[model samples]
Structures are given as structure tokens and as C-alpha cells.
Target: MPFIKLEGGKIDKEKKERLISEFTRIASETLGIPEEAFVVLIKENEMDNWGTGGKVLSKILAERGNK
Candidate 1:
């Protein structure tokens, strides 16, 4: 089985579905593997749990006036 893992901030269910479908479709075509043989896992983390440039992602978004 081909494993696909994605880790990031929260997203709506629809986006997750689309991501899984699209990822599997693309991978299947590129690798010549069946979609059913792929396993896709999406991990959603709180923005505060993510960090970049020595700053929490949540704080960075807040500073930029973003949600």
C-alpha cells in the first residue's frame, strides 16, 4: 500500500475529501497504482501547535490580522 500523510491546520470536511480524492487520483495515475491501494491520512493540528520562524502559527496569523 502507498501511504500518504498530510499534517496541517484544521480544514472543513469537504476540503479534506477533495484533498484525499485528488491526491489519490494523481498518485494513481503517476505511479500506475490503483486508488484502492493507497492510504491517505490527514492530521489536523491547532494553529498554536504549529511554529515557524520561532513564532507560533496562531500568533503569526493574528499579527497579520488573519484568523
Candidate 2:
């Protein structure tokens, strides 16, 4: 079984579905794994709970000029 975990990001339901579809396609084409054998887990966190360089994620994104 192949397990794919996607964490530390905010994603909508539509995007999540698209990710799953892409993963399945890649696994089947590149890894030769059946879609049924692949498992994907997505975890989302608030900006306050994730950070880098002593700055909160919201702050980091702001500093990088990404809204």
C-alpha cells in the first residue's frame, strides 16, 4: 500500500479532490500502483499554528507579498 500525506496547508474540498485525482494518476502511471492501493491524507492548520523563521505563517506570507 502506498500512503501519501499532505499537511500544513489550507485547501478547499474541490482542490482536495483535484489533488487526489492527480495523485492517483501519478501513482498509477509512474509507480505502477493501483488507485485502490493508494491512500491520501490531508491535514490543514491555522496560520498561527504554523510558522517559519520565528514568524507566523500569516506574517511570512505577508512579508513575501503573497495575499
Candidate 3:
């Protein structure tokens, strides 16, 4: 069995469904493994809970003027 973990900001239901489908397809094709044999875990975090280079996501986005 193979496990894939994806973690990042929250995503809408539609995007989540698409991601799952894409992941399954790629895993099955590249690894020659059945979709049922693979496990995928997605974790969503708030801006304050996620950081890069010691700066929170909100701050980063603010710096980029996307906030």
C-alpha cells in the first residue's frame, strides 16, 4: 500500500474532488497500483497556523498585496 499526504490551506469541495481524482489517476498510471490500494490524506490549515520563512500566510499575502 502507498500513502500520500497533502497539507495546505483550505480548498473547496469541488477542488477537493478534482484533486482526489487526479491523484488516483496519476498513482494508478505511474505506480501501477490500483486506486483502492492507495491512501491520500489532506490537511487544511488556517493562515495563522501555516507559515513560511517564519512568516505567517496572511503576512506573506499582505506583502504580495494579494490580501
Candidate 4:
């Protein structure tokens, strides 16, 4: 069994579904694990809880006018 843990902020349902499908497919094929045996866990946090370059994601996105 394979366990995949991801910490990506604020993903929509469609993208999350696609990611799970694609990741399962590739992992199953490459690792020779059954699709049903693979586990994928995604933990989403607010942008404020994630940071880069000493700046929180929310602040960075705000400065970039993205959020």
C-alpha cells in the first residue's frame, strides 16, 4: 500500500478529483500497487497557514492581486 499526503491550499472539487485519479493511476502503474491499495490524503489549510519567503501565502497573493 502507498500513502500520499499533500498539503495544498484551497483546491476545488474538480481538480481534487482529477488529482486523486491521476495520482492513483500513475502510482499504481509505477509502483505496481493496486489502485484500491493506494491511499491519498489531502490536507487543506488557509493561505495564512502556508508561507514562502517568510511571507504568508495570503499576503503574497494579496500583494500580487491574486486573492
TM-score of each: 0.96, 0.84, 0.87, 0.88
Tens-digit lDDT track for model 3 on 8-41? 8889989988888889889899999899998877
lDDT of 1: 0.98
Tell me each candidate's RMSD, in Å, in order. Answer: 0.6, 1.5, 1.2, 1.1
Please tell me which predicted candidate would have the highest TM-score against the true structure: 1
Model 1: ten consecutive residues of lowest lDDT: 3-12
> Which whole-number lDDT from 0 to 100 does residue 4 have in model 4?
83
**Candidate 1 TM-score, C-alpha based:** 0.96
lDDT for residue 47 in candidate 1, whole number 0-100: 97
How many pairs of residues collide in each model? 0, 0, 0, 0
Residue pairs that clash (backbone atoms under 3 angstroms), model 1: none
For candidate 3, the per-residue lDDT at 50 reads: 78
| Candidate 2 lDDT, 1-67, residue by residue in tens | 8998888678989999999899888988898878999988888888888877888988898888985
Alpha-carbon shift of residue 55 in model 4 (angstroms): 2.0
Candidate 4 overall lDDT versus native: 0.91
User: How should the candidates be ordered by TM-score, best one leading?
Assistant: 1, 4, 3, 2
Residue pairs whose backbone atoms clash in candidate 3: none
Cα TM-score of candidate 4: 0.88
For each candidate in the order shown, give its overall lDDT on alpha carbons: 0.98, 0.87, 0.87, 0.91
Mark the regions of model 1 whose C-alpha exceeds 4 Å error after superposition.
Answer: none
Q: Write the per-residue lDDT of candidate 1 for residues 1-67, one digit (tens) a residue.
A: 9999999989999999999999999999999999999999999999999899999999999999999
